[model samples]
Target: MPRRPISPQLLARQALALLIGYASARVALWLYLPLPWMLGPMFGCTVAALAGAPISGPNQLRMIVIPIIGVLLGSAITLPVLLSMPGWWPAFLVLAPFLLAALAGSYVVFRRLGGFDRSTAFFSAMPGGLNDAMLLGAAAGGDERRIALAHATRILVVVFLIPLFFSLVYGATGSAGGGNPARNVALSALSLSDWAILTAAAALGYWGGKKLDLPAYAVMGPMIVSGAAHVAGIVHVAPPTQLVNLAQLVIGVVIGCRFLGTTFREVSREMAVAGASAAVMIVIALAFAVPVAAIMQMPATQAFLAFSPGGLAEMSLLALSMGEDLAFVSVMHLTRIALVVAMARPIWRWVARRGEKDGA
Candidate 1:
């Protein structure tokens, strides 16, 4: 008998299945997991994709673009707080080593895993801007899809495990009152004027980042512009609630889209190795962060988020919700991004050369 043709209805059902798979994973993580929101969505996407969903499409741009914008908006929250501080330069000096070690350690883990190259493992494991990492991966000729999946898996594992670990080890202390200690910001609500200012900042930041080729345009751009706006007193208000929700939704949807057609069949032994490498990368990062967290006198969960080889938004979100040092996580995450970007080319080359020598 001739095989029946795949109808539009079937395609639609498949699409919905993909979406549901991803969404369910995310909702579970968002509700139950201890990780950040940004990480949850990516985790959902990977799970959905692994479950035979069709998230990966011809338009890869959407997968990469939205997260960039979302990250910018999220990171913008830090700008006003950071600018108000004294001796920002000195702060950077203190953070530089930790970030470098995180990135370098990631590379070492990647090299140790034989099937993949340094670029793939490094970009996959490097915790920073998700959008920036994807772009960097593409530029370095690393597999964007694999990197995306690896990133998603790391996020999922951390999100699912970290909170439980803390609760089991440290005991659940209710919602962690994580935020900047110095900032007298209000999260109850925001005025219309504040919303307008934030919107303008996001728009202008998007424009400027595209023009200047900044890393993680959406988050970074909006952050810089909005921060400047606050510093200049043009937008002297906190971020609005509606804008925050919108940013979360967009980021969640985009991250979820990646899980379109994932399944166990698709997860090859090599991919498993890559995932293990990513997990290893996270462990190494955690080890490096313990001393720093102790020196800084931060809580264990806060230290884990700060040092975990997870994305910036994910770690910061976890920190903020758990009532840890949001600013500290933000600064640490930014430092990691800057360090990775600065050293990406050399790292990529090193990985590539190493892979060749190893006949990978």
Candidate 2:
């Protein structure tokens, strides 16, 4: 179980890619754009990778970077953030139907239009759980590689583009992790003891997350711990803006490197199908947000953020950046992940069995 030696050339390539991405993010931030730290780095490395750069991301770097993101997200929560949870219960009612609709729309695009195999189409149509989708798809005799790539593309596209939509809606009044107009941000203002306590929380939380097998535990564990500490009034500090931006940049590079080994011709059709499915899900989320938001007496923006088809970490960070309700956003995304895990695998197996019987 010893780790393989990483090539120095690979490390150098990754560094160059990150430098390009980070530089690009700085320029974008200077221009006062939304999600500048993440968006620019992601797309910057994506272009470099697509143009046939022999580059891979430093996964170890992301492991460190992602947890910082978790800490930042956690600090957003306070007693007040948890107090706002009761108002968000109604939004969960909209999630089940929204999920069904997303599955149906994705099925149509992947199956009928794209001509993917039934199993691939079915599992790929699912709106969440990339790891589960890929594994279940493979177990059902579908193309696991295609499923993985499809999801990687879907998540990358969703996280990368959704912010722009928000930007146009919310305007650029807010900024990244530092000087947040919203309370509960900026790790730099903390004292030495505060840092010690927060980092201690992070380490313990990570251990607990791993023990519990939480999705994206590195981020989630620290987040839960940090949020708890803040809610308990144990600490008032958040992760520093410099640290937050660095985390975002490295994460952007990780996402961008997802495209490194594949050619456009190979993944283009799958990407198209996946992107279409994601686009359909986005529409469905937005469509459901309006009436639900009215009924729930919440902002349409809040509803949309809850329903958005992005990862928990990315969306939570997005909500934080735009000065939206982070607690509701984080919880809904967590619920969505749970829903997908409990439902997607069994549903795929049933469909796969049904397809086999029909084909006979």
Q: Which candidate is the best by lDDT?
A: 2
- Measured against the true structure, the TM-scores of the candidates, in listed sequence, are 0.71, 0.92
Residue 353 lDDT (model 1): 89
Q: Over the stretch 43-76, how does candidate 1's per-residue lDDT look in tens digits?
A: 5555565666544432233333443334333434
- Worst ten in a row by lDDT for model 2: 171-180
The C-alpha lDDT values of all candidates are 0.57, 0.78
Best by TM-score: 2
Error of 2 at 87 (Å): 2.7
Q: What local lDDT does model 1 show for residue 335?
A: 67
Candidate 1: which stretches are off by over 4 Å?
1-45, 54-100, 103-105, 108-114, 117-125, 129-145, 172-188, 232-237, 268-271, 350-360
Stretches of model 2 off by over 4 angstroms after superposition: 169-187
lDDT of 2 by residue, 14-119 (tens): 8898888888788777877667777778788887887888778878988767777777777778887788777676788778888888888888888887888888
What's the distance in Å from true for residue 310, model 1? 1.7
